[model samples]
Target: MAERPRVWVSQPLFADIVGRLGEHFEVSATETVVQHAPDAVAAALREADGALVTLNDAIGAAQVAGAGRLRAIANVGVGYNNLDLPALSAAGILATNTPDVLTETTADFGFALMMATARRITEAERWLREGHWRQWSFESLLGGDIHGATLGILGMGRIGRGIARRASGFGMRVLYHNRSRLPEAVEREHAAQYVGFEALFERADHLVLVLPYAPEHHHLVDAVALARLRPHATLTNIARGGLIDEDALADALGAGRLAAAGLDVFEGEPAINPRLLALRNVVLTPHIASGSLATRRAMVALAVDNLIAALGYGPDAGRPPSPLNADALTHARKRGA
Candidate 1:
């Protein structure tokens, strides 16, 4: 009998969901959520036929070059910046990411973060917890209102569209900037108006970033762009942390140039910028934007399905979540033939 293909789970996911992988392949899952070293990741790929990874486990050409047996990788999140696509394509390694699964949940979190930042919900809670209710007065913690505000979105993907749909309920004038404008029907459904990038920064009362991360876009929101924002405007990022320059943002927040920020992702996550930590006006959360129990479980399940299908074992073989690196699957089949 032919040997079963081996699959490595880079992080601890829902056990039951991960167990599904075991039925199709020999599964090896880490017991804890580990910050895997590059060497460790490369070592695992060397022995495995496929890998199930999250954003934290970055796989590139350097890592995959020597991974002769590695044919597939299933990423548990929507973003694939963690995977070097060009590198993966060069190596003919199929990669898949869980996209639609986390869209609504992440959009929900983005909107909530905007509300929290604009309303000073987290900051006021901290003050109350420290027994500063005695200092409370009508004007003590006044915050900008979310209703009747101009809301700008940086990316108009699925999550961005979802946010725009929610914005209509609050009567916000929705403006968005994307690499390309959405279709007229899509724009009508979301009630989002396309605006130039600079215009988005200048006009919005509340700005929410949902842009996909890319190398060229690192620190895309720099001091100059932040300067374009109205002093009373609030910024909320549920996207990648590298989008904003932390020092510039901190400087803006400290000088009262920007009202406040709500951040769910950071540039150097797990280790946030010290400048952001010291600000009471900012709301910081560990990267848990797609962390609802149902959504996370669904993500793991989808990733597992992707891994199974990518390895040509499941009912959906040859048709993974994303038709990523079809050339790789063709190469694998040719080798098998």
Candidate 2:
């Protein structure tokens, strides 16, 4: 009999999606839903051949160093900051993320959040719910407009392109800044202008953050960057939290240095900076940008597929939709390293 591969699921994801993994591997999962501490996660990884994790689980290099049998880690979200890439590479392990399936869905959420922030949707709803809507006034809920405004996107990847495509219908001028310039044809098709980061912060009436999180990208939108924006601008972040500084953002909002903000991710998961929460100008969500019923299910399905493939079962097992550390395979084979 073939010995079933030992797999650990770090979180309680979609039940059906998790159950499917059981068919191909010996799966161990937590019964109750909770964020596992790094020590707990490390302990679990020590006994498993591979893991299915969420962004909340921080799998650092030290943790992976102890996992002698660890081969692959299938992340439930598009972001992979939770997993230490250098550590994973050093350990010769594969890391996969569910990317393409969530692109359009996440972009839709980014647009919606931006609009909600710009138009004061959440604040207005709260005003009504608190029975403060006794009478109507001309400037009662005055907010910024989306049409004819400039939309600034920090990242020029798949999701950023999706956001750019949506700008046309709103009659927005899209400006983007990426590490490398996208093709001239793509820019012409989307009517997006590739600009410098400084120009993006200055001219954009609406700024959206979609850049990947890295140590170098930590606090990319610091207080200085926030100060550079127009006072009437709206800031939206659907990307990883570390891309912006929450305290700096709150300070800007408090001082009226910035108009409003929509945040789907934060520097820390489950715990948001209290300063941002105290302000009415900021709209906050619990990192569910790719959380549409259909999209989230698809994300889980792809993750399940990755786990199955990496476990040497499915036809495409070991071939993930997106592998963060694809170079690890080559390094592992070199000198049998």
Candidate 3:
């Protein structure tokens, strides 16, 4: 019998869901959590026909320079900024990500985080836990109101629209700034107003960052942008950490320039800024916006399906549902033809 094609799973995932890959191919999955360096990823891919990776593993030109046998990569997250798409395309490797499944789950968390930040829920809990709530002072732990406030969303994608729908229930006005204005129909569906980048910062009562990270977007919310916000306005970031300058944010929070912040993703993940940790006003969660049990399992299942189909081993062979570079697959087929 022919040998089964080899696959490498770069991190530990739900064994049962990932075990599905074992039925179709030889699976080499990581037993422990590992922060894979670029060179380490290259070494693993050198022997793999395909790889299942999470955002923790960064795969770029240097990582895939000698991965001659690597044909497909299934990322278990919606964002693929960790992967170098141009290099993968040049190498004729197919890359896929799990998208739609995590949308509502992530949007749910974004709204929750925003509410937590605006209401100072975590801060008040900590104060109570420390036995500081001896007397119920009327002025203690005051927070911004969510209802009847203007919500400014930096990115108006599917997740952003979901958040807008939620805000409607609270009677909050939804304002969004995106690369392009959403269609009038979509605007009506979400009851969202289109605004410019500067206008969003000036007008929002609570600002939520749902934008994707890119090289150009580094420090998109720096001191200058924070300066535009109302002194009592809150900031919630369910997006990438690189979008905000940590030092600037810490200074803003410390000096009371901004009311508070809720951050899920950080710039140097797993190793957050020490300054952010020192501030009580900032609510920090370890990059778990889509952390619900059901949602995570769905993500893993979708990634596994992408891998099986991308490798021509499943009923949907050659038609992975979320191909990042379908053009590369087409070119390869034409070359073979």
TM-score, cand. 3: 0.97
Question: Clashing residue pairs in candidate 3, if any?
Answer: none
Q: Write the per-residue lDDT of candidate 2 for residues 1-337, one digit (tens) a residue.
A: 9888899998788898789888878899987787787788889999798899988788988787688888889999988888888878877788889989999999999999999999999999999998988876877989999999999999989999999899999999999999999999999998999999999999999999999988999999999999999999999999888889888899999999999999999888678999988999999999989989999999989988887887667788667667889876765666265
RMSD per candidate (Å) reads: 1.5, 1.5, 1.3
Instruction: For residues 1-337, write the lDDT of model 3, one tens digit per residue.
Output: 9989899999999999999999999999999999987788999999899999999999988887898778899999998889999888877789999988988999999999999999999999999999998877999999999999999999999889889999999999999999999999999999999999999999999999999899999999999999999899999998899999999999999999999999999999999999999999999999999999999999999999999999988888988989998777765565456
C-alpha lDDT of all candidate models, in order: 0.91, 0.89, 0.93
Listed in order, each prediction's TM-score against the native is 0.97, 0.96, 0.97
**How would you order the candidates by TM-score, starting with the best?**
3, 1, 2
lDDT of 1 by residue, 1-337 (tens): 8899999999988998898887878888899989999888999999898999999998998788788888889999988888987788666689998889899999999999999999999999999999999977889988999889999999999999999989999999999999999999999888889999999999999999999999889999999999999999999999999999999999999999999999999999889999899999999999999999999999999988888887887789867877566676666666667
**How many angstroms is residue 17 displaced in model 3 relative to the true structure, after the best TM-score fit?**
0.8
Candidate no. 2 TM-score = 0.96
Better of 1 and 2 by lDDT: 1
Model 3 CA lDDT for position 174: 96
Candidate 3 lDDT at 308 equals 96
Q: Which of the two, 2 or 3, has more TM-score?
A: 3
